[model samples]
Target: MKIFIIGITGRVGSLLARSLQDRGDTVSGLVRRPDQQSALQDAGIVAAVGDLTALTPEGLAELTGDVDALVFTAGAGGGTAEQTTAIDFGGVVTAIAAADLRGIRRFGLVSAFPEAWRERHLGAGFEHYMDMKKHADQALTHSDLDWIILRPAVLLDEAGTGRIALGPAELHGDVPRQDVADTMAELLHEPQITRQILELNHGGTPVAEAVQAAVRR
Candidate 1:
C-alpha cells in the first residue's frame, strides 16, 4: 500500500514510517524541516517538505496524489493554547479536507487518552491540547471516510512488547511508542477496523488479537 504519513519526524511517526517500509509498503512522509528529510530517507520513505500549518489543496494533491491511506501523527508539541490549536486542530482540518478532495478514505490519528483531560485534570497547560484532539476526533467520526483514532496513554519510549490492550476511550494504561506504531501500521491494511476509537496499552494480550476484536465490533 502507498501510505502518506504526516509528522513523520515525530517519535511515533518515525517508527511507523520505518515499520511500514520494512513490511514492503510504499511510504511517503511529510516534514517541516529540510534537515529532517534524511531521517525519512534513511527509513526508505519518500519525503515531502511542507508545513501542516499551511496545508493546501495544491500541496496535498502533490504530496498525496497516489497514496492509499493517510496517518496524522502531527502535534504542536509544548506550546501555548493558540499554537496548539493552530497545529493540532487546524492541521487536522486541513488534512481532512485534502483527503476528501483526493478521494482517499482511510484515515488514522494519534490521540491522547481522554481520561487525562477529563478525570486527572492535567491543568490548562494541556487543556487546549486535549480539547483540540477531542475536536479532531469528533470531526473525523462524522466524516464519510473510514477512520480510526488511537488514544494511547502517556506514550513511553520502551521497546514494543508485541502486545496491547484495546478498549474504548475510557480505558487507561501506558503504551510504548513502538506498539502504537505497530498498531497503526496494521490498521493501514485492515478495512474492517474503520470508524472506531481505540485505546492502546501494554498488557498480556497480543496486539493483533486486540485489534481483531476491535474490528469484530
Candidate 2:
C-alpha cells in the first residue's frame, strides 16, 4: 500500500509512518518544513514538503496522487481556537477534498471522543480542540470514501500492548500512542470496516478481533 500521512512529524503520525513502513507499505507524508524531511526519510517515509493550510485542491491532489490511503493525525495543541480550527478542521477539509480528487478511497483519522463525554472526564481547556475534531470527523463521514475514525482517549507515551478495546461509539481511559498507531495500520487494509466511528483504550480484546467485531457489528 502507498500511504500518505498528513502530519508525519507529529508523535502519533511519525510512529504511524514507521509502523506502516515496517510492514512494507510505501509511505509518504506532507511535511511543512525541510528540517522534518530527514526524520521521515530516516524512517523510510517519503516526504512531500508542503503546508496543508497553503495548498490548493489541485496541488494537494498532485501531492497525494497514487497513494492508496491517507492517515490524518495532525493537531494544533493548545493554540487559540482559530489556530486549532485552521489546522485541525481546515486541514482535514482540504485533505479530504484532495484525496477525493486523487481517487484515494481509504482514510484514517485520529480523533477525540465526543466533547460532551470528554468534558465530563477531562474538563475544560478542550473546547476548541473538541469542536475542530467534531467538524473534521463529520467531514470524513460525509465524504465519498472508505473512512475509519479512531477516537482514542488521552494518549499516553507508553509502549503498545498489542491489545485494545475498540468500541463502536465510545470508550474511556488512556491509550498508548503506539497502540493507536498499530490499530490504524490494521484498519488501512480493512476495507470492510468502512464508515465506522470507533473508540479505543487499554483492554483485553486483541486488536484484530476487535476490528473484525466492529466490521461484523
* Each model's lDDT: 0.83, 0.86
Deviating ranges (above 4 Å) for candidate 2: 115-125
Residue 167 accuracy (lDDT) in model 1: 72
Per-residue CA lDDT of model 2 for 1-217, tens digit only, reads 9999998889899889878888899999899988788877876777888988789878988987698998899988777777788889999999899888999999899998663355565444477678789999999999988899999887899888988899776557888999999899988878888888998888888888878878854
lDDT of 2 at 71: 88
- For each candidate, give its TM-score against the true structure: 0.93, 0.93
Candidate 1 lDDT over 145-192, as tens digits, reads 888898988789999998888877446767899999998888777889
Q: What would the TM-score be for candidate 2 when compared with the true structure?
A: 0.93
lDDT (0-100) at residue 109 of candidate 1? Answer: 91
lDDT of 1 at 113: 86
Model 1: how far residue 74 lies from native, Å: 0.7
Candidate 1 regions off by >4 Å?
Answer: 117-121
Candidate 1: lDDT of 74?
88
